[model samples]
Target: MDNAVRNRAWRMRRKPAGLVQQDDLELVTEAVRALAPGEVLLRLVHVSLDPGQQVYMQSTQELPGGTIWPGDVIRAWGVGEVVESRSDRFPVGSHARDHHGVAGVQEYAILPEAALILVDPEAAPLNAHLNILGMPGLTAHAGLSQIGCLQPGETVVVSGASGAVGAAAGQIARIRGCRVVGLAGGPEKCAHLTGELGFDAALDYRSGRLAADLTLACPDGIDVYFDNTGGEILDICLGQMARKGRIVFCGAIAAYGSGDSRGLTNYLRILTHQVRFEAFAYYDYEPHFASALAELAGWMQAGLLKHREDVAVGLENFVPVFHHLFTSGISGKLVLQVRDGVTR
Candidate 1:
């Protein structure tokens, strides 16, 4: 409705040498104008800042060095509402869950239907689309259900247990009647994972002797491991896996920095134990998106599922929030609240 609109978004100010810090980004307001023909203008309500998105910000060997350009609006999957539209198919006031990482970031934006999935916010919480009903949700379902072959009454372990994807994976495994063990950083998060999220067991990696503790806690051995943290913990899983176990490497938050990517020397156990190690990307499971969302929604509606969120107010908090993730101090999905009325 307005010729010019303002948005607050994080922009890269400098290349991060090691761990990225707040000094690397700037939060500035931008103007938003009406769209071209067939374009729809959107106002971001809830933007999901995931661990993979954090890796995108860094210069990495996995991606081969193309980093987020300075001043480019950060890319992410988010939920927004169309306030103005030139496209008839997506009329004004329609809400959508966008697909592309970044095209525009604003209180108002003009976007294409190809980059967004339209939905009614009344159907679920806006943040749900960024969590249990969005990319992370799909990754958890596809990895556990399809790749991990999670069986009922089986023992399962989830590293990075409190993260967006890991949180969803823990609950889904429990719902499948599997005995779930969540490995996090501190006792508080461990308690939350076990008591609040309904996981059967929660282990703190920060405690002395993580590997030994993991061995003691999982005496039955891990039949399935949804690993988000690699490095030492991954090696421990390899050493302690039950015969014919399955492991899913979703993300490696531990190896994100420190400039070294070491391999697990204990991988020979995989051959002896006949364990299967499979790594997958959510992008590869595109078709399963709807099924995963439907199941997650049903669980939520039935009160058999719950999700928590640590919301950072304003886009300015985006850069600092990444530290909370790596430090393992933060709990639940890390969401950037660009504006109010996120749940409403």
Candidate 2:
């Protein structure tokens, strides 16, 4: 352990413009420092690429400086193994999922023991902790149970339905006896939603027939709308809400990179339909994590829940792979494989 290890990390090169570009991030290598008390050095195995990270980069409300500047290590969620540890909480050889600020696009990281969520490699594959059994899965549970107030036999439409959170939400709603319909970008993802995920129907938003397709799919009108993309798609769904319907504002990926902040035009429908709208964040339901995890795991093991991962290899490819999330058509969860030997 006397030799210093070279740690490679991706840092913001400049503030991103419209969509995240390849040059927006640069890979930098540095020698690892000695771990202090209560510190653990991790070898990152998998990293999650979420649309919310784009909003984090552009948001000025949360950061002290009002901007994520150059040379800053981009924040993300990563699953890694503790190669070295000085704390009993995160002993050496333990697998863990790191918290937001401590985890990033890096090959290795030195994080405090308190920031790690100890994971059992035997429970499920390591990558599953980043997908259906992780943040996105918890997000789906919180939105539906706490906010959406979903009822059996209701018609539910999930925007970005092929993405991680949306996919989980759709399947969970189906398990709750709701008629689940998903709206994805392409036909392939739409097909996967209906054929593989047991959704009642799937709509391709890119088909230019969203309104007609939605009407045909939900003849009774949508009782619950799990909105992942908030833009024109939201407007379309808003106009189709049933009386006393509920809307879960999970994300606004449509407006993340773009500077457009236009208000919803069809918002008056909420008042007319007596609709209830609630915004959800997974952290709010931390107390219920164990129950949610158990239920999702049981469903997964019973073959009732299914998920997919679009994995990109190597830390050097992090920037472009992240950019692919917004532009390229990807189904299910988007993950980056920083190191080898991690299971699916």
Candidate 3:
């Protein structure tokens, strides 16, 4: 290790308005200080990009660990290699991930063992630790199994089905023998969902015929709705829900960028049908993470689950790649590769 290693990071400069503008965050470089006892210095390979990042950029967003503010390192999760370690749990050269802190989105991160999740480099690609075998997959499992009470042969509808969490949710539902329907933005993403990911049907939300199309795709009505995008799509799903249906509210991408979530007018459907509506934060299911990870990893290794990543190289690409989340019709998990050739 070099005596003087420079660390590059993106810091939130101000609370963003509507879409996150380039000026909202500033890139800064400083020397990495020596690690303290029980700490590990990580060379971050890939930073996970999520829609929740948009909410974190706002000053008003309430967070358990507090919100990201001006001059604070933008919060993210990532997988990396321990380059230098002062902890027994994280030896040098071991792979680890920081899913509990704002230490990501930088070329290097110094974190304590308690904040790191030791990962198996041989189980899957290093970036997979940030995707399928990590938060997204875990979120999908928790939402469907714990909250949705998903049963075999049921009808499942996943909005934002091309996204990391939704894609996993749809596939997991399918693995349980459900009739899975996906809603994405474009034709290609829809095709990828049904053709590649084994969804029964996929619809483009941008199309003018969502209501009719959804009815056609799910004639029996949705038994479990894995909602990632809130707003009109949510309202449409609410209207078509079966009696005693379960809704797993995982994200609100439709409203995160603009901070203007549309209120549902069809909420009476909840009362009339005696349906259950539940929203969850990822960490709320931490106690069950180990079992969830094991099951998801097994499915992935057996080819029952598939994952995709739209990765951009360099920490400098962080801002633009994040911007693409709302503007560009990019599919799959979005990631920023801070260090090259660390996929192992």
The prediction achieving the highest lDDT against the true structure is: 3
- Which consecutive 10 residues in model 3 have the weakest lDDT in total? 57-66
Write the candidate numbers in order of decreasing TM-score. Answer: 3, 2, 1
Clashing pairs in 3: none
Per-candidate local distance difference test: 0.79, 0.85, 0.87
How many clashing pairs does model 3 include?
0
lDDT of 1 by residue, 261-339 (tens): 7989889989999999999988777787777778888998888777887877665566676677777767788777776
**Model 1: how far residue 290 lies from native, Å:** 1.2
In order of listing, the candidates' clash counts read 2, 0, 0
85-144 per-residue lDDT for model 3 (tens digits): 999999998999986755668888899888888988887888787788888999999999
Tell me the spans in candidate 3 whose CA falls farther than 4 Å from its real position. Answer: 1-3, 340-344
Q: Residue 255 deviation, candidate 2, in Å?
A: 1.5
For candidate 1, what is the lDDT? 0.79
| Winner of 1 and 3 under TM-score | 3
